[model samples]
Target: MNDTSEKSSPRPRATILGGGPAGLMAAERLARLADVHVFDSMPSFGRKFLLAGKSGLNITHGEQLEAFLARFGEARTLLEPALRAFPPNAIRDWAEALGIETFEGSSGRIFPVAMKASPLLRAWLARLRESGVSFHARHEWQGWTEDGALRFGTPDGEATFTADVTVLALGGASWPRLGADGSWTPFLSARGVETAPFRPANCGFDIQWSEHLLDRFAGSPLKSISLSFCGRTVKGDFVVTKTGIEGSAVYALSAALRDSLEAGANTVLMLDLAPDRTLSQLASALSAPRGKTSLANHLRKKAGIDGVKAALLREIAGKALLDDPAKLAHAIKNLPLRLDRPRPIAEAISVAGGIALSELDESFMLKKCAGVFAAGEMLDWEAPTGGYLLSACLATGRAAGEGAARWLRRS
Candidate 1:
C-alpha cells in the first residue's frame, strides 16, 4: 500500500503572456506550483528592461513606504497591497539573491551595483529555468480560440495552449519596438474586459520654439531649475529637446500638463530659473544700475541665469519684460512655457490607462475572465520615473503570479 497520490496528481499548467517584468515575475511565482510557461512576441525577452538598464537600471526607489506608495498617484489604493508585499527593500534583497547588489543614488533611486540589466535579467531567467519555467519566444498572443484555449500566432503557424491559469502582462503602448505595443486591448475587450484608452506617461511635451532658441539650445540641459504646473512644483533638471522640453523635471510634471492639454486647458509649465533666490531678492538685484552692462550679462551676474536658462527667458518673455527689473524678476520666478502637445506615445518612457482597476479582483484576477490576471503597465496607473515604474511593475507581476498560483490551488 505505497502512497501513489503524489505520482497520480499532475501539476497545473500556468501560462504567462508577455515576457516583460510582470510576465516574467508571474512565471517565477507560478514555477513552483504549476508548469510555468512564458511567451513573448519578441524574439527575446526583456528588451525594454535591458534598454532601461543601459544607463544603469533604476530598479526601485529608496523612499519611505508611504512616500513610495504615493508615487502611483490615483492607483495607490489599488496597488498598495502588492507594493507592500514587494517594496523597495524587498526589490534590493531579491536582486542581491540573484547576485546583483544595489545602491541608492543621491535622489534616493535604487540601481544595481553592476549598473546593467543584462546581468540581473540573466540571473533571473536562469533561476526561472532552474525552477522549471519554460520560455517561448516569437509567440504572439492572439486572444483565445472559440473553445476558450489560448491562441497564438507563431512564426510557423497558429498554435493553441491550454492552461489552468493565465496571466497577461502584455504591458502598455510605449516603446513599441521593445514589445509593449498595447495590441492586447482589442482581444481583452472582445472578452468583455473593460480597458482604458492608452496615453503617454513620463513623456515630453511639444512647444513652439523660436528659431534662435532651437538653433542654440536644442539639445542643451537646463540644470538646477524648478518646474511648476497646476500648483505642483518639482525641483530637478530637464533637457531642451528640438521639439520641446523633456527629462526628469518635465516628466515629473508631465501627467498634469498632459491632462490639462487634453482637457482643452491652456497648459503652461512655469520654470523657476533661480529657485534658490527669492522673487523680491531677484527684483532688488535686477534693480541695480547697469553701467552699460548687457541685459544677458546683467541677468547672468545678478541672478545667476545663463546658457539655456537665459535663452529660455529671452525666448519666452521677449525684450519688453527683459528691461523692467520687477517684470524680469517676476518672469524669472514664474516663466510660463506654453506647451503645444505631448510627444507621441511611442516616444514616451511609459504609458498610462490600461485595464480598468474595477475589472480585476483583489487578487488581480479578471472578474470577467476567470483564471486570467492582468499586471504591470497593462493596469490603469501612471507614475513618474525614478524607479516608480519598475517598482510597480515587479510588484504587480508578483501579485498576479501569486494570485494565479492561489487560484490554481483552489481549483
Candidate 2:
C-alpha cells in the first residue's frame, strides 16, 4: 500500500523523525488517534536539549505571548496559530502538570525549579510512554525506500519502515554531533522540496584586533550597554572574544549582521557605551578630567568605564577623540564597530535556513509530498535563544502532529 494514502483499513501509523523536542511533541500529539513511532539517529532523545540543560534547562520565558511571537520575524504569521494554541503560559502549565513545577528567573525566562533540562525531559519521556508513544533510537535516516517506504540505517545495517504519515523534525546543521547534522536535505531535494542554503544565525561575528588591544582585553565584558543595528536595539552585555565579540547583545543582532555579511555588505554594528548617559553629561564629565592623570585612568575613575568599554574606546577612537571632551563623549554615545564575517554555522546555537515556506502547506505538510510534514529548526526561519527556540519547536511539533492526525482521518 502507498504510505501517503489514507485507505480505509487499520489505524494510521505516524512516524516522527528525530527525537528532539519537536519530534517528541509530535509523537505526543499523534498518539491520541494514530499509532506513533518516533525514530532518532542518536542513541537517545534530546542530546542537545540535555546539553542545554547542562547549563540550565531554560524551557520558556514568562513574557507575554505576543512579544514572544514577534521574535520569529517573517515566520511569525505561520507560527502564530500554533504558538497561540500552546503558548508560554500553557507551556509552564503543561510542565506543572508533568510534575515539574516551573518558575520565572530574574531575566523572565522560565525554567523547572530543579533548573536542569534532563529532569523535565525524563519526566516528559515517562509521560510520553504512558501516552503510548514508541521510540526507535539509533536508527539513522537513510532516505526513501525502493517502494517509497521510509528507510533508515539501523545498527544491524538498513531497515525499511512503513507509515501512513511521516514528520521530519531533523533540525538544522548546528550542533551536528548531538544529532541534527542536516543529513536530510538531499533526501528532501530528491523528493522535490526546495531547500535554501543553511547559514549562521544567532552566532557571533569576527573582528580582527591589533595585538595591543587583543592581549590587553581579550575576555573583558561590556556591561549594561545598548547596541543597535538596522533599527533594532537591545540592551545587554557582550563579551570580547578571542576572535571578536559575542554574548546576549551580539546574538540578538546576529541575524541582521549575518544577512548583511552574506550579501557582501560592510555591516556596521554600533555600540552605545554609555546608554544611560547623555552626550552633554558625558562631555562635561570628560572635560572636567585630567589632573595629570592618564586618559584611561581618568575615564575609568570618572565614568565607571572599565573592561571592554575602555578597550573599545582605545581601539576604535584612539587618544585624539579622548583629547576633545565633547567629541569623545559623543563618540562614546555612538561608537561604531565593523563586523567582517560570521562565525561558522556549526558553532551557532541555532540556524537560519532549510525548506522554504513555499514548499509547505498550511498544515506544515510538504506541498508536493502528501503525508509528509516538516517542523522545528528544519523550516526556513531563525530566531535567537532565550526560550524562543524551545517554544517554537514545541508549537511546530504540535502543528505537524495535529495536521497528521487530521490527514489520517481524511485518509
Candidate 3:
C-alpha cells in the first residue's frame, strides 16, 4: 500500500483541434495531467478572439446569477453545467490570475483595465506554453483518416496524427477570413453525427431602404436610442448601414428578427428615438411645434433630433406625419423599420446550429465518434456577445479537456 501510494502521475495523451480561447484552455487543463497538442488552421491562433477584443474584451458581466443566466436564452439548460462549472466570476478570477485586473461598467459588463485582447491572450498563451503544451499552427483539420487517425492539411502537406482522446474546439462558420469556415460539418455528418444546419446567430438583418435614405444616412449612427421588436427592447446605439440598421443593439436582437423572418411574417424593429419622452407627453409638446418653423428645424431644435434620427422618423411615418407635430412625436417614439432577412453566417459574430444536443453526451463527446468531443461554438448553443462568447469557449474547452482525460482514463 505504501509503495502504491508513491506511484508517479499518469499522463494521458490528447489532441485538441482549434486554438482559440477554448482550445487553449483545454490544452492548459490537459497538460497538467496529460501530453497535449493544439492544432489550428490559422497562421496564428485567437484571431477571432483578438477581433472580439479589438474594441474591448468585455470579459464577462458582474450581474447577479439570475440576470446573467437569462441572457443565455434557449441555451440555458444546455450550457448550465459548463457555465456553472466555470462561471463569469471564475473568468474574472482566471484573468486576475493572469494579472489582468477587470472592472465592471455601470451596465455590469466587465472589462480588463488594459481593455485589449492582445495582452490577455499573450498571458494565456504564455501559460499554455509554460504548461508544456504543443501548438501546431496553420494546420487545417480535414476529417479523420479511414483508420481513425486525425487528418490535417498543413503547409508541409497532408499529415495524420492520433491520440488516446480528441477534443474538437473548431469554431463556428462566422468570419471565414479568421479561419472558422464551417468546413468540418460534412466530415462530422459523414461519421453519423446528427449535426444541425449552421446559421447566423448574433448578426444583423437587412432592411430595404429608399435609395435616398440609403445614400444619405448610410453609416450614420443614431445615439442613445432604444430599439424594440417582438417583446424585447435593446437600448443602445445603431448605425444606418446601406443594407439595414446594425450595431450592438441590432445584433443583439438578430436572432428574434431572423426567427420571425423564417416563420413567415416580416419582422419590424420599432426604434424609440426618444424613450425618455412619453408619446402622450411628446404629442402635447409637439401639438404646437414651432408654428412657422420648418418641421426638420423644429424636430432638430425642439426634440433634439437631426441627421439620421430625423431621417429615421421620416423613413418610418413620412413627411405628412412629420408636418403634424403630434404625429411626428408619436412616430419618433415608435419608428418602425422592417427587417427583410438576416445577414449571411459569414457576417455574423457567432453561429447557431451545430452538433445537436441530442447527439452529444454530458461531456460534449459525440456518441457516434467514441473518442471525439466538441466544445465552444461548434456545439449547438448560441449567446449574445458581451463576454459570453469567450466565457463559453473557456468553459467548454475546460469541460472537453476534463472529458478527454476521463475518457482516456476509462479506456
lDDT for position 123 in model 1: 97
Q: Please, what are the lDDT tens digits per residue for candidate 2 over residues 72-125?
A: 899987888888888999988888888888889999888888988887889989
**lDDT tens digits, residues 155-184, model 3?**
777878767789998898999999898899
Cα TM-score of candidate 1:
0.96
TM-score of each: 0.96, 0.93, 0.95
Task: Give every collision pair in model 2.
Answer: 6-411
The sequence of per-residue lDDT tens digits that candidate 1 reaches over residues 28-132 is 889989988898999999999999998799999998999988888789988999999999999999999999999999999999988999999999999999999
Instruction: For candidate 1, list the clashing residue pairs, or say none.
Output: none
Please state every model's RMSD to the true fold in angstroms. Answer: 4.3, 3.1, 5.0
In model 3, which range of ten residues has the least summed lDDT? 1-10
The CA lDDT of each predicted structure is 0.91, 0.87, 0.84
Candidate 1 overall Cα lDDT vs. reference? 0.91
Regions of model 1 farther than 4 Å from truth: 1-9
